[model samples]
Target chain A: DTAVSQTPKYLVTQMGNDKSIKCEQNLGHDTMYWYKQDSKKFLKIMFSYNNKELIINETVPNRFSPKSPDKAHLNLHINSLELGDSAVYFCASSPKIVGVQYFGPGTRLTVT
Target chain B: AQSVTQPDIHITVSEGASLELRCNYSYGATPYLFWYVQSPGQGLQLLLKYFSGDTLVQGIKGFEAEFKRSQSSFNLRKPSVHWSDAAEYFCAVGARLNRDDKIIFGKGTRLHILP
Candidate 1:
């Protein structure tokens, strides 16, 4: 059983297009996060949600938004996507008591 | 802000050789440090974490990490290297907040194993 899973393992779109990546965790975790791994393989936090509430929002552009409907799900929506948006996105979940997070397989987004 | 740093960008080790990956963090208080490994086209997998108590913590796959408060470092080490161990390793610092917690990760160290 996969603890964390993300939809659209790969995404390819043109500039100015809008897309959404869905994430779900079956680990019964209270906190979920979204991360972006750039071409240089640098992983950076984008957003974090606890119990469906936005908690940590990094210095990301407004074009990128994360929405969590519940504790088990978090979705990322990007608007006006540009070529620079090309990267791998990973979703992770962790329990409140223990901060250890389990990550999803990741979604590779390529914007041309 | 809390952050983790990986000094080495890449490292090469021969099979059966010992290996160590360096990691450092900056925080005001005792930080929750972790080491995560990422195989090609796979998600990051937790190797070990240092929350409290003993400085040395053992993890899966014969991996271990020692947390040094004075140095503010958590270095991952293995007795012997396996070709299958080649992967990207990330060091992270988990910061607890009033409402939620967040983990800041390092750029990552790529390990290459030789036959």
Candidate 2:
């Protein structure tokens, strides 16, 4: 079984459209994170949640929001998506904060 | 603030040749270092990590990394390179006292293997 998984591997939407990506981990971790990888392949942290509590919030725009209903799931929702929002979004989870993390297949968002 | 630097944007090595990827990090205290590999359109896979006890740590797929506190460097090396080893390598650093538990990642170095 996959340790971590994400839905909608690819998404293409027009400007101003809203989209969401779902992530789940079967590792029973206490922390989960979301990261964005630009076309240059530069990865940046977007948000992190620990036990359903928000922890790290980077300089990402407000259009992106992460929701964690439980420790095993973290979902990202993008509102009014712009061309700049198009990138690969990755979901990761770790046993705790500041340790090895497990990543899921990324969701590629294409904005037109 | 903690940061990771992977000076090389891309590196090319012949198959069966030895390979080394340099990584340098800046942190106030002892840092948790990690090396991850990401294949095209795939997710990141942990190559190795160095927390404590050992300066040299072995990882999956015949990969290894050495951590040098004096130089603030944790470089990944392989005795031999294979075609499947071609991928993006990222070095990350995590501060032990960091409350938010965020790991700073390098821009990533793309590895190319020549046939």
Chain A TM-score, structure 1: 0.97
User: What digit string (tens of lDDT, one per residue) describes model 1 on residues B2-112?
Assistant: 878899999999999999999999999998899999999999999998889999999999999999999999999999999999999999998675564577889999999
Q: Write the per-residue lDDT of candidate 2 for residues A1-112, one digit (tens) a residue.
A: 9999999899999999999999999999999999999999999999999999999999989999899999999999999999999899999999989889899999999999
Docking class of 2: high
The DockQ score of candidate 2 comes to 0.87
Best by lDDT: 2
Query: How many clashes in each structure?
Result: 0, 0
Model 1, residue A32: C-alpha shift (Å)? 0.7
| Per-residue lDDT over A1-112 for candidate 1, one digit per residue giving the tens place of the 0 to 100 score | 8899999999999999999999999999988999999999899889989889888898999999999988999999999999999999999998872399899999999998
Q: Estimate every model's Cα lDDT from 0 to 1.
A: 0.92, 0.95
Q: Which TM-score value belongs to model 2?
A: 0.98
- lDDT for model 2 comes to 0.95
